[model samples]
Target: MKQSLTLSWLLAVAFFAHSQSFNNLPVNTQKPPLHGRHWMAITGKPLAATAGAMIFTKGGNAVDASCAMLAATCTMWDVLSWGGETQALIYNPKTKKVIAINALGVAPTGATPEFFKGKGMKYPPEYGPLAAVTPGTPGGLMVMLAEFGTMSLKEVLAPAMQMAEGYPIEAQTANSIERGKEQIKQWKYSTKVFLPHLGEKREAPNAGEIFVQKDLLETLKKLVEAEQEALKKGKNRKEAIYAAYDRFYKGDIAKEFARGCQEQGGLITEQDLANWKVKIEEPLMTTYKGIEVYKLQQWTQGPAMLQTLNILENFDLKSMGYNSTRYIHTLYQAMNLAFADRDFYYGDPAFPPDEPIKGLLSKEYAKERAKLINPDRNDPNAKPGDPYPFEGKTNPYLTLLEKWGTAHLHKPTSQNPLDENFLEEFAAGTTSVEAADKEGWVVSITPSGGWVPACIAGNTGIGMSQRMQSFVLDEKENPFNVVAPGKRPRVTLTPSMALKDGKPFLSFAKQAGDEQDQLLIQFFLNMVEFNMTVQEACEAPSFKTYQMYSSFGKHEKAVGSLTLNSEMPAWIRKELSRMGYKITYQDRTSGPINAIYFDWENGSFWGGSSNHGEDYGIGW
Candidate 1:
């Protein structure tokens, strides 16, 4: 009888152990997932996430925490700088609405197609002052903090300000500086800040070495002083923050910024600074299987995801099997179709030649586009379709579209070879920030442009944006996106949010240039369709297609090429190759995707930071 009791006990113990296992999903992940009850902060760097946690601990909302994270990452030079542009999507709990922040900078004065053509360029230069747009991130940060945050600008910027004074540099940024020393030496102010030991064997700061930027510290202080003075003059919180914004765009700071830009051979004027404003606009949304997905409007490549989702909705993706050859082919073809439309039809809404966003997002248009998918093999010659007809307008650029389709032939523009890593320079990756609170505030941001090898704009200690290269030189390539002074470029910086049952469902963003929407689409589906946990979904093997034109340098494309996770089965690779795919393998195809999933059943937050990069997350 004692032996029988022991057997029963062992069975019970085994059952309990199985039930207690937290990760019940089939997939294994390199990193453990994060769970939080009150708040969650995730960003590209560890210090940046810590900065967000500091704001959350101070009783600030998600917007405040996100702004703090953004500032800190920019200060750390995590693929960006203070002068980079910011694109964000914020979920305001009070209004129960999602809002898009269009903080992308516009082409400065004298920036035009003719101007670029005169410089003997196919498109804008990839780097240097001539490639810069007017600074937008400073204005973006102040506006987001003032409009939605409960904390003051001074409070939100505390962590970044401290870092600007001096902080131990991480290996990533330090090594990037070392590798780009030659480029850094070309710019006097950049050399002054990035190379502390200019004449040493390693000109850049060593890992863990203290790196300081006195000019940036002083510039931040000047903005704070303006805000404080405004408060003393009886200004409201929002007004006081705007006071700082005014100082940056129209006051002494603007004078220095414009002068420094021109001194570096850029075209920005003080009037350009004053004229540039932060636009808080309505976001575009499309419902995917009862969940409402939101993305910034036409100026960004975000709508392409919506279009891809729309096309994909017609197929039964779940039955095709996860990571199966058929599934990969479907997604690749759908993305190519959507991105082809994006390459031609997307641009700034505030400019002329209005984008047919209405027709592009129409269900009928999606259905028509979906029918074009060749089930047997890849369609390297897939071209943009007529979206205008769905919106009741005749297609005005049909002729250009036809000629462009035949002329491109899925190849890079005929340009001189690059000295840098062509793929990395083509992607021009950035960093992302994700934050959320139990109070219902959610923020998703993808800010980019001024990376290492960036040119610094004089004593302002700000790196100039390299975003002007995103503009097309010829109207036939993308008529709506042709470079013009005061027009925003068609950028790849896309931040995404989702809502279900009238509440926040997921807040996610990533850092790859033209591949942003592609990676995001897979990440979102990994959870919603495959039933994987957030972290599993984040680290899951994903494939990349280069059938669409790149949004960065040379606007290149390689027809029939696909990058799959290196661990993909040999049989799967053979099958894909048989279908006419030029397969390349990478150990990690999931680029730093940071996300927050709302655990409505538990009334908490689940955060996911991919294991591949230095992306980190904290929950409390």
Candidate 2:
């Protein structure tokens, strides 16, 4: 019900924002992309930003600050649930090492292709307990703190607990609740928690109305209690932190998760919960103009960004002119190629039929793939390239995307066909947080899973993830994304870190799904090629292609669909249209981005946020 109304509401809100920013941005003193001296933190909410800043002032490092911010934001944004998925990339300057955390949960012990194939489910249901996997956000956050944070779990989570206990949610969050009001009704516990006092249904809260989630507060407190009890029993802080992690994945919470899944006809079992563990691996690195860009391994769309950058290096972007017809066309072609490779090759490492990261990231493969681009007109299709010998082995395509029959692969009137407005609403919203300390310890994390479709694990008041839906039911020829027990679906929740001359240069993250890497590429170019500031790069107009199959529901591919930000010049818009590119302009499709960069020349730290989602950044 609220999603239906959000389009009109968001438009009103966006119009006011654009109007104000447009009038004052060029000379807007007290502008966005705020800077800090010794440190900086940027998050989706100002309150969450404060939580991180408070941790930093308390002598905590970037890892500590990130935990605090993420926990607080989960409290503030209904779109960010404690039981959601999380992926983070952390860089430690002293060790000169970067660790990638894959906190995304796996398919349940019983989630095989049998049920989905027999049921003829082209896509799984969006809102329900049956759609969920074991929740992982709580576990992931604890692991991060235990390994890299200076603060204890209890100390870091104080802010979030306080908010859940009692606080007034303003207009923005209230709108999100309104958006998912109907979905909340679809689940038993979700409705009980969100609409407890509202009689038959949930009503949107007005600004300044006192809001409370006592159950959620209790859930958070239980984790703290478990940790404190372990400490009392002679366990050190780190052991106690691990105790909390074990409690979430192997103890009482895990039991409840299994019980809820069983009752919901879901595939998860207690064993799956106990067996689930997040992986902390070294980053997958690729070079771009002498800088080392790092991303998560095969399970994410991270390499697609690397692939896009490699292809674009073959073209002189500055000479083509930024946002020009040729520039946009070239970008579209490169992105489509990368995405084709992504759909054909990318998959979970623990699962077979996944892409070979080493082969895909090789410069030689990029050089080979660069030859596929056409200069004059848009080609509304994606023909995947060979990424074999690079990965040590090869698997032929399950079904050629080109043979799918239409130049426009999207079926607008098909079941569950999503218009742009509905598509945005269905985005399974993701949030990003970034923190950097004077020691050069930097972390970028994208955490998400909300209550809209997922259940609150049986009275635990923690939302669960519908991440299992990210997999495909391809049983025969495709291996990249086929469903099976214990497989991690190909996720779009990728964070990035980079080095310039072997020194930490940039740490950033964004909230878009498959479109994330595309936006990240454009943001980097805005800075390197155009010499724009961190703030300028974030605020610059951006574009993305939907020509590649999306990572979410039904794997829909809107071929040749080019979505540009409304802020672009009119001439460029017309020029793009003239080239037969299926173009549409609205607010950003890649969503809001946030970053913290080191200004080497000035010997200062600079920070910026897209601020499109009411984000905030602080540096000091």
Candidate 3:
């Protein structure tokens, strides 16, 4: 009897341990049958993507759904908000053409370099009331929906407004909100929305916890009503969309925004808002491996994507092996080279002509510069090289190159070292949405607003952006990023797409500051050349180099390292170091990158989200 009892007790203990181990096992919630058609969507937050997909299922076109998703994301993901500027890349299968929308907001008219000097400030304020520019989200979304969409603003905005009025905060949303609480507390309006009743610290609102944004809901309703009224006047979708813009820019919303700016001594003016218009410009395009790549112009960091591709083309990437140390070194070299040029020349083309970074992305210029990359040696602190100019006298590209090369080579500079082991924090709280309709029209837009101050009061619920912090006040007493009368601030919000064989091949983008272009280039290479599936391409580890000073500073210059997810192979790191590429093993700091690729032969649409983000992609 004693032996029997002892055996039974041992068995019971063993069973309990087994059960506990099983409970602790990670769950694979990924559903199977993972392929589909009929419009696909991907973004940073899973809930935001689902919301956009739902709109598509309701017979709304990509633009309509994207517009709704953008508004909803601003409320849900405070880290990336609508109050900031936006840049988009769209493809029209009907026209077989790609177009870019520069919805970036301009500096206020009175904004000048002297403004910062007068304030005794050297850096452009990135957040608070000072950093705010004429917001372009309303205008950009309206333009897309008007020109390419089939649904009305009322229909598209209904779901988002409902979401704003009362949607549960997810774990991702809670994390971001908490992270940004300090900045949010500065603005009364932002504080009200994020921290309704603050006391001792407590658990943040979790996933599925209801969050109601009464003010934003009301704002959406007002726009919807105005749009409906315009439609009643026999205005078509385009006109009605403009009507919405007018309601925001010239109507009551504009008045409120202007009033807020004035009260806070901000640069935004009513004229700035009314005069704001989205520019429909030709996309900057280049061919890589017979695949056509399209990116926005200099307004954002779009040109870097082109330059990286140009450098990669010079090497036989496939032969080098994917994600190998050789491949990563090459990629790092290409990025550093392009980034050097981007820091010197790229800016709002609308800015003064003398800005040093223009024409860096010209095809002739790219080809010439691509030859300078040396595959074997890692020029740790490599200086920019002069590529023979194709345009005019002085060959600004070569001139700037020569000047920078001499300064870089001879200057007593500290080789800024990066913490090879320091991990970058993943920006998991933003959102992205992409859609295409049967009409052969595709729209991709990403809305973000974290790290900036939030106005919880007034229920503005929108988060602030730190983009303005990148601008430098010139020695000539000019505010390089001043909120001037009609000038938009420099931004990193670049959206991209690709075309192959005259069809929509890829629509993808991310929301990180400099990593946007780096990630996009990788996606393009992964899809067009490596033949990786959409999911595989997006899930792959990525790297970025910020060796030069851009509108964003060179603070991370010494940190010439790649931030890779832990999943990346250790051998790859060893190889990269051997090739002179500094390796920074990060858990995941790259922002959420979402992509959709259309397989012309398969007649199927492939969509996938980054493994590092809280986003999802689904189709039906």
Better of 1 and 3 by TM-score: 1
Tens digits of lDDT, candidate 3, 351-388: 66444333465566666666666777566666554432
What is the per-residue lDDT of model 1 for residues 154-209, given as tens digits with 9 covering 90 to 100?
Answer: 99999999999999999989999999999889899999999999898999999999
Error of 3 at 34 (Å): 4.7
Worst 10 residues of 2 by lDDT: 20-29
Q: For each candidate, C-alpha RMSD in Å?
A: 6.0, 5.6, 8.6
lDDT of 2 by residue, 98-197 (tens): 8899898887776777777677776554556656766778878998999888899998999898888877887777766666678777667777666544
Task: Show model 2 residue runs off by greater than 4 Å.
Answer: 1-30, 200-202, 391-395, 398-408, 412-418, 425-427, 451-453, 475-478, 587-590
Whole-model Cα lDDT per candidate?
Answer: 0.89, 0.75, 0.63
The TM-score, computed over Cα atoms with residue i paired to residue i, of candidate 2 is 0.91
